[model samples]
Target: MNYNSPHKGMTLIVKTITRITVGLILLYGIYITLHGHVSPGGGFAGGVIIALSFIHLMLAFGKEEALRRLPKPLVSLFESLGAILFFTIAILGFVGGYFFLDWLNKGEPFKLFSAGSILLSNIAIAIKVSFGLFGIFLVLVLLKFTPKK
Candidate 1:
């Protein structure tokens, strides 16, 4: 629960560099998530990048600081919301009388915001994965720092 860890020894410059790297990674994650439907990147890849951002922050600073940036409750809410959104989208296809059908408008290919259903799915997945990984990471960090009984 302590933000100031006694184990930290990295110089200010190193910490600054690390923070910059983490910020870049987070931006990349958002890019991947947004462009998932049009390119090779997707929810999973974007989610991993998002999680890596937090991981990098945790490594550079500490668990407490990372948690401050991304609280457990918020992450958990996002995870649940993402799951619900994904399921709702999937259900829409079924309600439309097609199994796993792509309901959203599939616009021109190679466009930034084309492929509506695919984009929606990718976004849902990204949110789910990012929050899920963050939750897991938070738990692991807590366990690692907990004092032995």
Candidate 2:
């Protein structure tokens, strides 16, 4: 059977499997990020997982397909936005007379919305880490494969 698609990479089985599992991977990453405070995994861990999903796609479907899903410009944009979001939230903490302070009301312990600023921070960190890691992976991959002058 012809495994080749418009974009080139692994075989049909690999692609099929990747297609089935990538979304689950992404969702798991998100779950980790959201419940970070209540659980062990946090933004950094979740972000790595998220980035891995995209990397998996690249490995299974090739660079063209991966780039099509997350274009370079969008990656750059997300990276910037994540940083901006993190910075903005940090700055907002000044309202409480400190940097990175938990200005928002701390709800009941162990609840989803219990940690206000922390949740936001985790989200920002996740966004930054996910796109940042993906960007780094892209750079390393492209750099290594590029022809020497």
List the candidates' TM-scores in order: 0.84, 0.90
lDDT of 2 by residue, 42-115 (tens): 99999999999999999998887788779988998999999999999999989999888887998998999878
Among all windows of 10 consecutive residues in model 1, the one with the lowest summed lDDT is 1-10
lDDT score for candidate 2 against the true structure? 0.89
Candidate 1 segments exceeding 4 Å error: 1-10, 144-149
Candidate 2: clashing residue pairs, number: 0
lDDT of 1 at 105: 74
Shift in Å, residue 50, candidate 1 = 0.7
lDDT of every model, 2 decimals: 0.82, 0.89
Total backbone collisions for each predicted model: 0, 0
Q: Considering only N, C-alpha and C atoms within 3 Å, which residue pairs clash in candidate 1?
A: none
Q: Which prediction has the highest lDDT against the true structure?
A: 2
